[model samples]
Target: MNLFNPSKRVRNLYIKYGENPFVLLSKFIYAAHRQKWSKEEIERVISAAKKGNYIALIRILRSHTHIEE
Candidate 1:
């Protein structure tokens, strides 16, 4: 699930949706692409979630309180 080497689905999404994360990383038909959360962002979420699992990240808030309210 390396964001570095995007999968075919990601490449297609990137081409159709462009490089903006708002699209490519939004709904790429691949959970891995969606879950390819950045380490920094994950850290922030971790600092907030405090031992949270990846499943709760969809809401972001549930995963990370750092998310601007």
Candidate 2:
């Protein structure tokens, strides 16, 4: 399956956050269950994670957004 259609939460996170993991993660750890997540946020996260870099996620955490990861 393509990462865009990921099977797990992490992959979904990767798909949704893109290079800016902070947006979705800022609101939810894994947004698959929640209906609050916007498509823009999901797309951003997904795009960010697909880039295969965690620096953005780290940067987001640096802001103290209460990330569970």
Candidate 3:
């Protein structure tokens, strides 16, 4: 996936949850847990998300999770 330019799936997610970081973050966390990600990996994503750039957070989550379009 292109990191610099958002893909169609990512754009769709932005449209759905752009204004709600909490909701997006929750989903990311849930997905991480469901995938049985390591604590370190989950913590890394959470720390990155804490930077308050939801777009980047979404991109990071997308890279880590398998979300259908």
TM-score of every prediction relative to native: 0.25, 0.31, 0.58
Model 2 has an lDDT value of: 0.43
Residue 9 shift from truth in candidate 3, angstroms = 15
By TM-score, who's the top model here?
3
lDDT by residue (1-69, candidate 1, tens digit) is 221233222222222222333342233324323657555553443344224343333333321212222
* Residue-level lDDT for 37 in candidate 1: 52
lDDT of 2 by residue, 1-69 (tens): 222333223322332334354564544444433645456655655555446457655443233222245
lDDT of 1: 0.33
Candidate 2, position 52, lDDT: 47
Write candidate 3's Cα lDDT for 1-69 as tens digits: 322234212222232446577777777666656666566766776776667577776666565454356
RMSD of each: 13.1, 11.7, 6.0
Q: Identify the runs in model 1 with alpha carbons over 4 angstroms from their true place.
A: 1-34, 51-69
After superposition, candidate 2 runs with Cα above 4 Å error: 1-35, 53-69
Model 3 misplaced stretches (Cα beyond 4 Å) = 1-19
The TM-score measured for candidate 1 stands at 0.25
